[model samples]
Target chain A: MRTFSRNNLSFIILMLLPALLLVTIFVYYPSIATLISSFTNENLRIPSSGKFVWFLNYTQLLMKPEFWQVTGRSLLIVACTLPLEILIGFLIALLLNENFPGRGIVRALVILPWILPPVVNGFLWNWLLNGEFGALNGLMYQFGLIDKYVFWLQHPSAQIFWTVIVQTWTRFAFPMIILLAGLQSIPQELHEAAAIDGANRIQQLFKVTIPLLTPSLAVAIMVEFISAFQIFDIVWTLTAGGNVGQVINPYTKTLMVFNYQMVFRDMKIGMGSALSYLIMMMSMIVGVFILRNLYNRGVDK
Target chain B: MKTIMKKSVRYLLLYTGAFVALIWALAPIYWIIVSSISTRTELLSKPYKHWIPTHPTLQNFIDVFTTGQKYRAGGTLPTSELLISGLRNSMVISVSVAVLVTIVALLAGYVFARMKFQLKDPVFFYIMLLMPLPIWVSLVSLYFMMTRLGLTDSNLGLILILGTMALPLAVLLMATFIRDLPYEIEEAAFIDGASRWQTLWLVIFPLVLPGASSAFLVSFLNTWNAYMIPMIFSNTEKSQTITVVLSLFIGQYEVAWEQMAAATVFVMIPPILLALFFQRYLVRGLSMGAVKG
Candidate 1:
């Protein structure tokens, strides 16, 4: 029996080996390498063995005005989109939670935008919002809403606003699903008790529903905050990373886009590595809170 | 009369909200389909002619499938070959990553779910921490690593990278599903004198098929939709995915709206079908780690 138990331990180790090895090489190793590379002078454009620069990249990055601008823009995007996503998500989830004919079908169809590739969503919106021959302009003209077509992606501010809109469109379904699950798990008896106490629907929602839905809402916000901070795919396809030329559109360049230009286009590998760590640290701050929440919930369970 | 009015108001609000939801979800999809089928002349016309296409055609989709087609503005439509190859590469990568990640995650998930081990909680927690680490943090090093190993521009490279990207979630999902199962069955298998391997394969495997399928579908969709990794890693047509190829269509000197729409439609079909058919599993898999305990 001792030998058999020993064999079972080996079997368990063998089962976990492949996943462990993959995660170590792909996930953990690259992370450590990025940290190490950030301290070195690694430039792909310059043919030189990268030597330890030790704080040069970080100091340079911190001093750049563009760095602060891009970081601010990324945060602004999170601020603008998170509330809208949560609000619309909550409203839709509430609407969907009520009994109706074809509720399931509506629920399924609503997730269409979420499931479509983010790149495809970007292109789809680009076509619709095109200035010269856009469907949006056509619809507005026909409805007498506008006298002429407008170049939607022309101005930098408009570009940023549209990015927020498209981001909301692509992402709202996720929160809706999370919140819907939260709503379903809330015992119907709570609402019933509230109603018996002469509470109105709005009162019950504020008194009971909102309070119960906090955990799911927190999960949605944290996850969306991370995604919105790392906004790349939509921005890349929508505005061409602000047209990818001599002057990158300052308004539209978020952190990931800035990192891409730094690493890929500029080939400033060292600076890009530093930027990557900065982005990771910002995200990790949020991630730590999320893990704490998960840990607390796990303990309760 | 007041009761009737209140009830009517409730129904009115519900249906109105549902109508708006449908339009919100389906309008962009509908517009893309409309754009894809419209004639190039009609699509290019400045002022709108019709909300619905007056004369729809499938030429754009045909152009996507066929090679050597000429653009209306007189340049060779170079995307057909690229798009087709992209589609094939995407399929190969997504399918392979799905199978590979699913099998690996299932093994790890089972061990975490059923086995006793030292430092198990810490190990599992460490893996879960990888979940929130944005992919950009390691992309630079990954790029260098892939290039050093000569894995760039290769489907296998993407399969490996994308499989790792999908791993943490798949493992969590599989573990969640496995944990929900009754322990009595495994105990009964043990009492039958079956080896651990035999019990895992014959007893646990069949029971966890649903979880496996969920993990597979999620991984498949994620790989199919992955852009940044494939974009950086696979620059050549050899391994560029449909998403990457479609991205190349935009920001040109003269954008091809009709054909781009067609390609967008083509890329959307699989995920739409998956969402429609396996919604229960998709929702369960997606919301696994975030919402559930």
Candidate 2:
């Protein structure tokens, strides 16, 4: 048995070898190197192995108004879009949960927006919302809502508003799926019991359904919060990162977009690395808080 | 009469909600498809002439697929050659990442599920920690490493990065699948003098085929849909994926809506088909960890 156990150990090590190497090289090493590089004066254009300059990058970034604007914009996107996504997702989930004709097909179709590559969603919306020849403008005009075409993406505030709508469209399906699963798991008897106790549908929904659905909602919120906070790809494609020569769009520069410009465009590797850590730290803090809430809620139940 | 009215209203509300959901889910896609099949004249006409094109044409799609043809929108647009090459590159990278990641994930997943190693718990926890760290956090360091290794603008570089990105989830999914399998099969194989490696291939492999395919499909869709990594890592035509190529259509002077829409449709077809056909696996693979947690 001892010899067999020894042989099994070697097999285990062999099996685990590839995953360990890949994760270390790709995930762990880069993460650690990012932390170290954050302290250096690394610049891609500068050709030298950058020297350590502790907190210089952090201090400089903290002082920059552009940094705050970008960070604030990212947070604002999360604030604006998270609730819309959750509410729409919850409402859709509730509607889908009830049996109807072709419910299966409708559920399948609902995943379309979520599955489409976010870049494609951006392009699709851009086409739909184009100033000169957009379908939206045409429809609104035919309906006599507006005589002149509204250039949706041109104005800054409108740009932010549309960004939120596009994001919600692309993402709400995920929370819907999660919430649908949550709903299915709640026993039918719970609703029956509520009805027997003289609770109306709305009352049962508030008293029984909402309380039971909190965990799934929490999970969905955490995932969506992180996703929205790290918004990229869509914003990039939507605004084309704001013209060629510019560093970033003043209106829609989220953190990831800002990091892209700093690291890839400006070649300011040190500043970008610092920004990366800060973004990671913020996400981690929020993530841990939500997780603790989830854990405590679980314990209580 | 009151009860009937209430029941009728409930059904009315449900169907109305379903109708709105359907339209919300599909309108953008429908518009893209309409635009793809519409002529340049129809697309650019003020107050757009028709809800569905009066004169729909497949010319845009043909122009997208045919090589070396200059797009109708004229000067300096992405030639058909670039879009086709981009599609090819995407296919290669996605397939390679899916296969390689699944194999590695399966091996790792099996050990984590069945082995009783001293470091198992710590290693698993470490991986879980890495899962939520956004890819942007490592973008800079990874760029430097890839550049140093001469891996920038290469297929292998993308496959490696994307595979690594997909690993933790793939591992977790595979582990869950394997844990559900009874261990007696493995025990029987071992008692028959088969090696652990042999038992894995000959016994466990067949049992976990469904899980493996789910992992493969999810990874494939993820790699195919990846834009940011490919956009940064792959600079040249040789390695640029469809998403990167499609992005070039925008930000151009006098944007070619028709051609861009056609390309978008082409790029969307594979993922849309996969999602529709194997949605069960997709939903399971995507939501498994969160729901389990």
Candidate 3:
């Protein structure tokens, strides 16, 4: 610290001040403002009088029919994706981590879905699920499996199903990578020691691998859950039509997407701000829940 | 016999799992490559949808770049001046935001990591807590903030929003990576009269370039795919981005499935190719959790 010259200190200070100021104004201040907005009826215009409405927004959100339904649907998708992603991700990561042939290629190939832009995921799935021209039907036809091309994104059930699969595809590679790191970090000797004591592979996995992987798995679940809950693009891409409420719950469309619709489509700035605040609060609750649950496990250890 | 049977089942399960994941991973990509090379008639062709094009061509790619004003019908992709400007605007915003965010986060990250400031622990947790909300929510409020400040419809307004959006993750990540840096190296630099900026630029920056790179890439991806923020603040021809232009595919009356797909593939390529090259870093970065810092 003593070696730093005044010029050097000032230069670094100058480099950082603009960014810090930006964060304060844009990030921090707005965050506080959102908390305030959630309680009021502030719309397209900011308050002329700093009007404060109590828990009106939160209470209104609770009564909205679209709200609970969307939460349920979001939960359904998260429920479906989380365990399978963990199990499938764990097994696949294990195989790829094995000192086997073409391991590097396998690792690289598995991560392909992660790098594509979110919009592309939307478009690619759009083509695959295209009723007439989609590749999915083509592949099924090639195998003589189906006589007709299914309009996968048209039917509500099919739409939700495809959205889950697409979202899972885009996300699973992420958890796999994390769990693999956790797996590889564990020393091989633990398994060897357990095996010498007459434990079988199943026992070793249940007793050693699973417990050791718990912290990593917890982190993976937290990431997957938070991401899954806010999922928008896949849904928006699939049925950005009159279907937001008809096909799915209003909120399942994502707090962000809902904000877009409210602000841009409906042109209700106050309601949109209200929606954004709700989203921030919901995500914060989820985030805190994850931290408590996961870190508690660590603390228990 | 029992042991052999068990080994076979384990191998079978492993192979089955791997194959299923591989299919899920490959389908959309195969669709992208095939669609990129297909003709319009071929795309709309009948039964047994060609999984692979019978006659591969780069016509779609050419059409994407060359097609004049997106011929919007009742419902279709916006093929107007907005599209071209949107493309250029995306390139500018994503790259510039990535650079500005990365550079700023570098110093803040270093300070947070090495400076031993008060409330650092609480602040770091606060950043992590703030990370989960969809960025659009941030933009909705920020748009109002910008409007109040009279900064809407300007590129700098966007740069400011996107830069701040990138910082929390950048600072958190930069701090952790900097923590792992050998304190001795900085001490050596200091003892040798290497000023703080000199040490940061010459020594620390090089050491944590990966963190910077990862942060920059995240910033780029956020700005690149961002739809809502840009849509609200820069709905004008001069300011909006590729995502908004593409969303025109969803306008109520018409849907341009083909051209929209074409537009999508165009915007999709740079980031996908970027991910392909940096997939290693991005994954490593994501897994670190600290990488988001």
Stretches of candidate 3 above 4 Å error? A1-16, A43-51, A242-255, A289-301, B1-19, B68-83, B133-137, B250-259, B290-293
How well does candidate 1 score on lDDT at residue A56?
A: 91
Error of 2 at B188 (Å): 2.2
For candidate 2, what's the RMSD?
Answer: 3.3
Error of 2 at A128 (Å): 0.8
Which candidate tops DockQ? Answer: 1
Off by over 4 Å in 1: A1-7, A241-248, A294-301, B1-4, B68-77
lDDT of 2 by residue, B42-147 (tens): 8888874477899989998887677434533335445777788899999999999999989998998887777776767677656556567878777789888999
**lDDT value, candidate 3, whole model:** 0.69
- Interface C-alpha RMSD per candidate, 1 decimal: 2.9, 4.0, 5.0
Off by over 4 Å in 2: A1-7, A46-49, A242-247, A288-301, B1-10, B67-78
On lDDT, the stronger of 1 and 3 is: 1
Error of 1 at A20 (Å): 0.9
What TM-score does each of the candidates earn?
A: 0.95, 0.94, 0.86
As for TM-score, the candidate ahead, 1 or 3, is 1
- What's model 3's lDDT at B222? 69
CAPRI-wise, candidate 2 is medium
TM score of chain A per candidate: 0.93, 0.91, 0.83
| Whole-model lDDT per candidate | 0.85, 0.84, 0.69
